[model samples]
Target: MTEEPLPTNASSGVVRVGDTVRRPAGPWTDSVDALLAHLHAVGFHAAPRPLGRDEQGRQVLQFLSGEAGSPDPRWSTTDLGAVGRLLREFHDAAADFTPPPDAVWQTAIPADREDLVVHHDPAPWNLVRRPAGWALIDWDAAGPGSRLWDLAYAAQTAVPLRADRPLAPTLPRLRAVVDGYGLDDAGRAALVPMLHRRVTAMVELLRSGAANGRRPWARIWTEDGPYWQRTADHLAAHTDDWAAALG
Candidate 1:
C-alpha cells in the first residue's frame, strides 16, 4: 500500500505502507532505531524491526498485525498473564542493549536509576495482543528506567489500579500478572508505591500537555484527569492491601 494514514491513533499521526508503518521522524528517532536494531540483534522478537527510511524521510517499521488495547479493555486472565510474561522477556532481552553514541529519548523525566533501556511507557494502550504473545509498540517513550518501575507502570495501567473499579475484581488479576512476571517479594512490595508515583507523573504530563495544546493528552486532561487523580490517591491509600496481596 502507498503510505496512507492508518486508523487514527490517540497520540500521533502515523501511516501504513504495505506491510510497514511510516512515522514522522523526530530528533530521538535515531536513538530509537538503534535501540530496536539492538533488540533484534539480541534476539528479542516482539519489538518492531526498523526498515530503511521511506521516500518521505519517515521512519518505517515492520508492521506487526494484532490487537491493540483501549481505555476500557476486557482482557482475559490468560491475556493478562501473557502480557506479564512477555514484559518480563522484553526486560530481560533489553537488559544489555547499547544505544547509539550520544543518544537521547522522549523521556518525561530521567529515570531514577537506569537499570536498562526500558519501554518506559508499556501501558496496555501501547501493547499489541498477538497470537504469538503480547508485543509492546510505541518505543517513542522508551528509555532508561528501572525494570520494576516499568512493569509496575504496565501492571497498574493494565490492571488499572483505580477506585471506581472494584478492588476484588482487579486484585486477583493483578496478582496473576505479578506471578506470571515472576516478580520477587521485593518487587511486589514496591509495585504499588511505584504505581502511585507513575500515575502522579502521568497526571502532570496530561495537565502540562493540555496547557501546551497537545492531542489526546489535552482531551484526557479535560475528561479523565480527575478520575485518575482519584485513582492515584486510591493507590497511595491501599498500598498496604496491594503489597499484602502481591508480596
Candidate 2:
C-alpha cells in the first residue's frame, strides 16, 4: 500500500515520498514555490522549503516535522495568545514579498472590492505546531483579500461548540487577532459584515462549483457553505446576543 503522508486539511492532495511531500499541482504552485524559496532565503526558516516537483509532476515540498491539523477547541482556547502572535508574524513576513507570477490563488467575489493578501482558508489543518513555533501551512488560496477574511473564518472555526461563550466573547479574541496583526478599528469593523457575506458566499460557491463539474472542490464547497451558513444564521438570528458577544 502507498504510505500516505499523514493527511492534512490542505485543499489539495498531500502525500509523502520518503522525506518529501508531494502536493497537488495547480496554477499557483510555481508562484507559491517561488514565495517559499524567497522566504527561506530571507531568514524565514519556519515554513517548508519549496523543492520543486515530484516524479508524478506534483508540486513537491519538504514536510514540516511536527503536528499539524485542525484546531481543537480544548487546545484552541489556550492557544489564542500564541496563535495571535504567530499570525501577526506571518502577516509581517508575508507582507514583505510579492506573490510569484504563476502562483495559483483563489479570489472570492465578496460584495465590495477591497483586496489584501488573504490566506482564504485558514483552517486548523493548515497550521503546523513545531518546537520552534507555529507554522502556517497550505498556501493554495494565498492572494489579495481582506485581513478579516482570515479573522472571521478563524474565529468561527476556533470556537468551542459547548463553551456557551456567546459572540461577544469572540470580540476580544477577534480584536486580539486583529491587534496582533497591527490592523486598525476600521479594518476590524469592516470584518464583521464580511463574515456573514463570506458564509453566504461559501454556500453559493459550493453549490455552483458542484453544478459546474468541479467535483472534488464541489464536495467540500457544498459542505462548507451550509456549515458556514448555519454559523451566519446563528449570528443573524442572535444579532443582539452575538453583538453582545462581539462586544
Candidate 3:
C-alpha cells in the first residue's frame, strides 16, 4: 500500500506499489505499453510486463523481484555476457513489432535509425538482477531505435567507457558483450562510431537541458555534466582503438 521510490537517474516519480511499479505517464505511454506487450507475446520476458495505468494516471508495470543498480564490482564476465544475450533477445523479438497508428515516443535524443522500438536506455542501472535471471526496467524510454544504437549505449554504460577508467581492461568486457550478442562484421565496424555518437548525444542533451533549466536533466547536468563531456571526449579520441579492440 505504501509507495516506495525506486532508485534511478534516468527518470523520476517511479515507485513500487505491491507487485507493480507506478511511474509518471506521458503521451508515449500507449506506445511503450504496446511495445512491452509485443515483447512478451513473442516470448521475450526480460522486461517488465505493462499493467496499464493506476488511479493516479501513472503507468503501472510488474514489480520484478530483483535488485537494481548493483555495483559493477559484483558483475562478472558471465553477467556481462548474459546482459548482451538478453539485449539481443529483446532486439530480435522487437524487430517485428509495428507501432500504433498514432504512436508517440519520448525521443530525448534522436536515434541513428528507426529500425524498430528498443529499450533506448539499457544501462546497468536499469538492469535488475533476479535469482531466476535478469530483467530490464524503465520502459518509459522505449521507442524508435536501432540495435546498434541501443547496444552502443549498453556497451558504453555496461562496459563503462568512463574517462576515469583504463580503456584496455574495459575492451575485453566490450568484446564479451559483442560476442554474446553475436554481432556481425558490419555491426562490429559500426559499433565504435555509434558509441561515440551516443555518448556525444548524451552530453549534448545534458548541456541543452542544463541551459534550458529542464527538470531532472538540468539537475543531472549540474551534478555530472562534466563527467559526460569528458566521457564523450574520451570515446571520440579512442574510436579507432575501440573498433580495433572489437575486431
Best by TM-score: 3
Query: How does model 3 fare in lDDT?
Result: 0.88
> What digit string (tens of lDDT, one per residue) describes model 1 on residues 62-167?
9888988886667877777887898898888887888777998877656657888888888887888788878888887778898877887788878877788888
Q: Measured by TM-score, how close is model 2 to the native structure? A: 0.79
Candidate 3 lowest-lDDT run of ten: 68-77
**Reference-based TM-score of each model:** 0.92, 0.79, 0.95
lDDT of 2 by residue, 124-194 (tens): 66777899987777776667665566766655555432134565556555445445555565665566676
Task: Give the winner by lDDT: 2 or 3.
Answer: 3
Residue ranges of candidate 3 with Cα displaced over 4 Å:
70-74
Best by lDDT: 3
1 or 2, greater by lDDT: 1
Candidate 1 lDDT trough over 10 residues, lowest sum: 2-11
By lDDT, the better pick of 1 and 3 is 3
In terms of TM-score, which candidate is stronger, 2 or 3? 3
